[model samples]
Target: MSNERLRIALARSGHTAASLAQQVGTDPKTIERWVNKGRVPRLRNAHAVARVLGVEVRHLWPTLNGRSEVSGPVGSDLVAVYRQRSDVPIETWKTMFDQATESVDIMVYAALFLHEQISDWNGLLRSRARAGVRIRILIGDPACDAVRTRGEEEAFGHGIESRCRLAHMHYRPLLGVDGVDIALQATTLYNSVYRADGEMYVNTHIYGMNAYGNPLFHLHRMTDNGLFDAHAASVDAVWCTARPLTGEIPDGSD
Candidate 1:
């Protein structure tokens, strides 16, 4: 009944039919049809186009639910979007354990969420690692240039670095545990990423801004090559560049 969603999305992204078509790898006329007639693309292409346009598919087609409205050539999976990192449910964050089969990976500047949100996480990881789940966590090095720059930009002074140090304390319990790897990096983290098998939660970072306010994406593995892979690769790249936080980590409590 309404087509303003598609109209608004195009306007917000500043994407024209030609530009969007080029990014989505579709015909310009196809985009024209979407804009002029409010036609929706197939599930696979819808996700492709949404990623290109930097939006949730539902933002373009507001009337539909991703589960019902989309069905990929391979499978129907969602890439849920949130306006803020906190918008995602706690259960969704915890559900990573349920979904993870082979590994669990996280890359963040300071994982205050892990410290403040979850309870008894050390015991939880002990159980998971004992069960053969390989866990790797990467946090920012407090003394690194990237942290210093970010601290100044956020106007938090040394607060960001302090948080990173606090995060190391929270993770101290897992320091020597088998199958758990913790590292620190000086990389310029443009996005905070967390991955559990095929699903990934990513939050984009804005200049001089905290990560919480940035738009977050919970991308499910709907295709062989999609946003999930891109994010996973990013985590791997950072991991390779990072220095392992080896040896005994001092156990500091809250």
Candidate 2:
């Protein structure tokens, strides 16, 4: 009955009103009415709607004790995970991400600069750093230049540059003499989507899991486990001596 809920569900599935109607075996006009005229579908129709959209029946009927409406804690395994060909849902992912404790380390071959929401994630990472959660990023050197010139001594242009500047100012340490918590690293061929929060780790495949082209993969779970641990240690070592991105380099010779 919630119009917004129905609309969001449809958007998530990339459904057109007409396509949705055909999928549910309803008339397109009826779906149009439900979406625009604020008409709620009947129970039988709702089931059809949910079924065709690959959504839970409870999502359409909130009062039906629908377990799908519940929001679990961040570290919780979801009741179901729906995979579609699009970027991960930011809002939902954030709720899960916010629950991370201890640390997050990202090793990526390439990263498109960031989404608008990423600043919040960056901030969250900073908070995690303060709380003793280690945060480390291993980003491709090529990707780094997209934001900042590799060896040039000036700040990148525009407002985003300021955000980049601030990131380094409050940046938490993953290593060095005073460092203990977070570590981040990068490799040119690394490409898997890896996230670890608390004891749970989820790896989403941008490339198929079986593909060996990605440098980011772990060979054996045990071997990779040790490697990741060692990688984290190395990150801590680098962060210790690395100048804060916000501050000018001491030599001023670069």
Candidate 3:
């Protein structure tokens, strides 16, 4: 079968076989064979193509062994580690979002701090969307058992659910904006992920401590199946099962 993923990614990235081949230092016929004849490129070529396309190699070739593509030591993708989530400078968050040119994705339970702390959070998202950056947000479903359990675990009682609802309200303005999407997920998140292009911040969720008190990891994607890709896969999985926002919060029954 043809590599539809490659074909679609090329179209979305506005790259024809000739242009992609020119960048990757290959003949256009090779690219056409990779897409039309389903032939995988060499490891280096695959990595180069994925980098130029701004995507993970595994994303274009799902069955490929991502671990085999690593060229450096483990944890090479780690950029930094913050002792506490709150220890991450606000400016860092701003820079990440501001520098994103391709995509911004978030997965959280009640990241109320983002809206409360980031200056003009909604406006920033709108601006990114207007710039043609795709944004996908997956927040916890306020009425889901996962939220309730997490609230109790965090000693917040029903406050976690309230924050989820409030977060929904804060994101309401971007509901129908082009290139922006909001979804509600019921998964038990172990780490909240905030990604802008190839870099991301991962906030670890402790059993009894509030998220702000937990550790955070800053990772930049370096290989096809590295630390960054692992978290990104989790985010994608949750996003797949999430329900899209409809400009109205779901009642408990939902």
Badly placed stretches (over 4 Å) of model 3 are 1-73
Task: List model 2 lDDT by residue over 1-254, tens digit each.
Answer: 33555675676567999899988888988987776665767788888887666554544444443334333332122223334313233444444345456556554322323334555555666566667765555432222433333223222233323443443333333233232332222222222344444222223333332212222221111223353344444444545533332123112123
What lDDT, from 0 to 1, does candidate 3 have? 0.85
RMSD of each: 12.7, 14.2, 9.7
Candidate order by lDDT, highest to lowest?
Answer: 3, 1, 2
- TM-score winner between 1 and 3, please give it: 3
Error of 1 at 87 (Å): 0.6
**Candidate that would win on TM-score:** 3
User: What is the number of residue pairs that collide in model 1?
Assistant: 0
Better of 1 and 2 by lDDT: 1
Backbone Cα, N, C clashes tallied per candidate: 0, 15, 0
Pairs of colliding residues, candidate 3? none
* Residue lDDT tens for model 3, 178-201: 999999999999999999987789
Query: How well does each candidate superpose onto the true structure, as a TM-score?
Result: 0.68, 0.35, 0.71
Predicted structure 2: lDDT: 0.44
